[model samples]
Target: MKRTIFQSIREYKKQSILAPVFVVLEVLMEVLIPLQMAKIIDVGMAGDGNLPYIIKMGIILVVMAMLALIFGAVAGRLAAQAGAGFAKNLRHDIFYKIQDFSFHNIDHFSTSGLVTRMTTDITNVQMAYMMTIRLMARAPIMIILSLIMTLTINAQIALILLITIPILGGILIFIAKKAHPHFIKVFDEYDVLNNSVQENVNASRVVKAYVREDYEIEKFHGISKVVFNLFTKAEKIVAWNSPVMQFTMYAVVLLMVLIGGKSIIFQTMETGELTSVIVYALQILMSLMMVSFVFVMIMIAEASADRIKEVLNEVPEMQNQPNAQKTVKNGDIDFDHVDFSYAGEGGNLSLKDVNLHIKSGQTIGIIGGTGSAKSTLVQLVPRLYDVTKGSVKVGGVDVREYDLEALRDQVSMVLQKNVLFTGTIYDNIRWGDENASNEEVQRVCKLAQADGFVQEFPRGYQTKIVQGGNNVSGGQKQRLCIARALLKKPKILILDDSTSAVDTKTDALIRKAFREEIPNTTKIIIAQRISSIEDADQIIVMDDGKINGIGTSEELLKTNEIYREVYLSQVKGGEDDEK
Candidate 1:
């Protein structure tokens, strides 16, 4: 896991390495300052007031201080650079990995979970990385060097630290062990908190229409309170750090003063030597305290690191076969004895033993009630989800054998709940074919019956679409999405209930344009309204994860009970409307 997360520190290796080097230099300067002070006090102050020697030592001290400040500043800047750069690369890798994930892989993670991992989890890792490079490096070095200085000046007094150090170390270990579990629980709750905010924001309109704002607020507060309690528990455990550090520091200082004063009185230690030993003792204790602080951060970051590694270690379930086919030859689709389950093998099936064949350039319409697996069937053509058993073939080759990008480029799918990004209408349509010319874009919009209403806007194609295209009517959003798909000019176009919002007249015109203009394109339409698919060359009726009937509309009207019942009921309803 550590190896996986640290792999994102690609270009920042130099900064990461150099930051610690400067930290060493800074610690050296700080350690040397106390030794110099001992000299200034002994040789200068006590040696009959040697004025010139005192001035020389004072100047040297100032130089050391300035150098220490310079080294510390450079180390801080480099650490910041390394941390921020590492975060950017990590986020890039995570996002690209998500793009490669199949729908099956994506189902294992929630949208808000991914968001928290990329944003909050990565931020925590970044801070820990910076501390590891800077303070972590400084603390240990300072402790070792300070301990050496103290032992050199007075070994008997230094033994106090050895005793106090372990006592403090044991306390810290206990705090760390107890606090870590709470931190893990805290970050997991962060996922729930973020998910709550995301769902409420996305469904703001529905909540308002139903007048459920108070309910949403109460639910949000419930989630927030859980997060708050978890974080409080973790922090309360960590709060033991400061008091423990203070007591250890004071105890060490008291022991040093008493022992050193007795030694000085017996003439075994000079005043200057006693002062330097005290300074070194303080440095050692301070370094230990800094170590404890870094330890706490690592404990928190350990949980975050695991979350990040979860994403980085995930292997995309779908990938191109070796020596994969690069180009799709045609739109011919063949589903051979296909059986699929959302759960892995040996689970309840969503699509069961479905066998069907679609010729290139044929217009196929599928009508099914909810839970009929209509969308699931077309998703297989683009290799969105691989079949659990048997094979799905496109252009006479198994879909798994084709390069994922190449196959998806030729198969354009406009879903029932299609999405539009916040951009101009031109920008949204150009997502289909980025290199398409202005004339080509306008032509597809015309075919989709979107150009007329689009032109009615003051800015025509340049009009800005708000988030989710909320400013537009439902039919307008659907037509604009159709225009975007038409711009792809793909070999196979799948419309999964995409035209339900448009009126019958507009829908018929769009289909008429498809017949006249793009007759070679294979079109598949999934719709609830029978009128939408009555004129189709071949219509499929699906029921309970199986194909109940497959024929032209007229043939199905006579032979298929489900199709006949639906057709007569719709026809009667139309006559009643006329009355």
Candidate 2:
């Protein structure tokens, strides 16, 4: 346990050593002050009382106490500063590591588990480090120093003190070991409770729409109940330690008084000496009690440290290779006999034998049924999840060979679910291009058909958006996301059913703006609506992760049954509009 504690402290090397060194000095002052009081009483007040000597010892005690207080304060400040700094660095490291995790690694821990590790788990370790340095380090020093002083005063009474120390130590050690596993259980349940609450909060709208409020409340209560039970068990184990230590101290003090009285009567110890021995005995027991308290803290910290280590030790699935080369061109994409599956199961492919190529100035549309793997196929282009088989090349180079950042920068995707941060309209739009001028942002907003509503807001471009853009309509949020993506002027732009919420008129305006303003960029539009992709230069029809047909809309309508069926079902008045 001591080695583990020291190893943990080494993470804050200089601060840890300095804080404890000051604390040990303060403990020395504490032990010396009591001895000085015994001297002032026994020697200064003995025979013809030495007034000058008593005054000198009194002054010395006061000065020592003052110094101890100053050192205590300094140690406390240093411990807190060190604890906070360690926690800050730990959180930053964990957060940055989490960012490097690919979809596979992230899914293993879940969102709320990672959040719990970053906040609650780190806090436990920080509190432990602070308390260990501020209080625990002094416990042993004070106990040992007080015992030495007690033994020097009288060995007989100190013998009784020796017996109680082992008994109390044994009890504390037992309780600490018993409570350690429970503390771990408590934190695990805490993760479950956090996950439950977070899930309900993020999906509150869906819960309300389904009218499952009571059901959700029941589920939350169930999770909270488990956490409460675990906490109660841990508290019970910890609560037992204090009373048991106090009992042991009381027993030792009673025995010491009896033995010291015998010594006084036998003339083997003076009255003042007896007084000093008893005081030192009490100090020893009190210091042991403080040490026991530190032991309990150790148990809790051990549990939390294990939790923190779990996150810190996690190996991220996606990391840059040593000195990987980056792609150099603007926008050219090719999928060569690509096969992929979310399951990564043997011989199971989400996309199979797929080959496609798009040049820098081409517009392509992708259409498929609900389970046709349309989104998965495009996601591979951005390397969100790498393909299980074959190669996806961007700019005539394999994407895996390109620097991750450089590859992602060349492609911009507006997913079906548009996510918005809590910020002003201008700030959200600027996410695409951090250094974009106000005119550039405004231009994209106009292009995405978002300028009119944005201008009408009370603060116009500066209007604040709630998280998820909850304050705005769905169409408005989609348009804003589109504007953000457009602002990047990406080499390859992907719209994965992003314009579904907007009315046809707005959609047409956005399409017109895209054609006129950014005709040189390669575009991939994945849509379920026939009208949405009817005018593309090429349309690919997908079925069961395989490309079933690829041709212009007119050619597909005449020759492809699947494409014709989709067109007939969506076109109002059917065959007449199709013709």
Candidate 2 TM-score over all chains jointly? 0.94
* lDDT: worst 10-residue window of model 1: 285-294
Query: Per-residue lDDT of 1-579 in model 1, one digit per residue for the tens?
Result: 288899999999999999999999999999999999999898899847999999999999999999999999999999999999999999999999999998888888999999999998899889989988999899889988988888888998878877877788789878877888988898888989899899898889999999999999999999899988988887898899889888888888888889989998998888888888888888887887777777878888888989888888889999888899998999999999999998979989999999999999999999988999999999999988889998999899999999998999999999889899999999999999999888888998999999999999999999999987888999999988888998888999999999999999999999999899989889999998898899988999999999999999889988999999999889888999999
Single out the weakest 10-residue window by summed lDDT for candidate 2: 1-10
Q: TM-scores for all candidates? A: 0.98, 0.94
Per-residue lDDT value at 430 in model 2:
95
User: Which pairs of residues collide in model 1?
Assistant: none
Tens-digit lDDT string for candidate 2 (1-579): 234323444457778778998999898898888788878877999899999999999999999999999999889888988888777877877787778877777777867778887888788778887888877788878878888888888887777777778877788888878877877888788888888898888788999999999999999899888888877887898788878867876777788778878887898777777777777777777777777777777778777777667666778755667776666486788999999977775857889989988887688899999989899889998788888889998888888877788777778899988999999999999999999999999999999999999999989999999877879999999999999999888888999999899988888888888788889888899988787788888999999999989999999999889999988777855567768
Q: What value of lDDT does candidate 2 attain over all alpha carbons?
A: 0.83
TM-score of 1: 0.98
- Tell me how far candidate 2 lies from the true structure as C-alpha RMSD in angstroms: 2.6
Instruction: Compare the candidates by lDDT and give the number of the best one.
Output: 1
Q: RMSD in angstroms, candidate 1?
A: 1.2
